[model samples]
Target: MRLILRNDLRKLMFALLLLAASFGHAGATPPPKEDQIILALIQRVEARTDLVFVRNGSDHNATEAAKHLRSKYKYFKVELIDAEDFIERCGSRSELTRKPYQVRTAGGAVRDAGDFLREELRALRAN
Candidate 1:
């Protein structure tokens, strides 16, 4: 009888530990607002296949642009304060060539990448 009770007590303790762990995970903090905005911007870039991203005098597809932007975001994350900062630092220009990035629409209209992203950001905020 004592052995049976000991085993039951051990099981109860294990159950309690699992419950506590689950509660701890539930209370974990989420990413900052800036990070959320930056991720949204990246997603926007990835979804827009109609626009050509111009970096260093070459054009890239949306997938390539999104990948490049993600790498730049990771590299410059520590220095970034907000979504605008991220656009300016990571999405705006080529770090090596010092040339501003551009976006060409399907109709051959060109605009600065920074301006495009800023407009997207504003649209996101509006919604």
Candidate 2:
């Protein structure tokens, strides 16, 4: 290999820096949520919930996913509200903020999804 002169090395380094900067944000997007085939995903989640026992899903965050599961189970209720809406009502600093569907049920009855479902669904349905 031939030695690069000081000036040549400087230029090469600058060129490399430019190239690196140009590709800096190539993979920076937040990532697309599979909106197109959301229906398919909902169906699959529903099937999974049915095959197994207990509650499975969220409330405000995963409305679409939850609704699909509910439809499949006929007893589960999936209510999706805007994260901002939850924050606005409950306050932004709340841990549940931005979660939208954090899977909250009544009286800590999450383990008992089928039992007291009416009470839990009503609570989850709350804004």
Quick one: best lDDT, which candidate?
1
Question: Residues 1-127, candidate 2, lDDT per residue (tens digit)?
Answer: 3456877988999999999989753433212332222333343334433232222343433444345343432321122232222222222122233332233334433333222232333344452
lDDT of each: 0.89, 0.36
Instruction: Put down candidate 1 lDDT per residue, 35-116, tens digits, no spaces.
Output: 8988988999999999999999999999999999999988877777788888988889889988999999999999999999
Q: How much is the lDDT of residue 54 in candidate 1?
A: 96
lDDT of 1 at 41: 85
* Model 2 alpha-carbon miss at residue 45, Å: 17
Which candidate number maximizes TM-score? 1
Candidate 2's error at 87, in angstroms?
15
Q: Which stretches of model 2 miss by more than 4 angstroms? A: 1-4, 28-62, 65-127
TM-score (C-alpha, index-matched) for candidate 2? 0.23
Can you give the lDDT of residue 116 in candidate 2? 26
Error of 2 at 64 (Å): 2.4
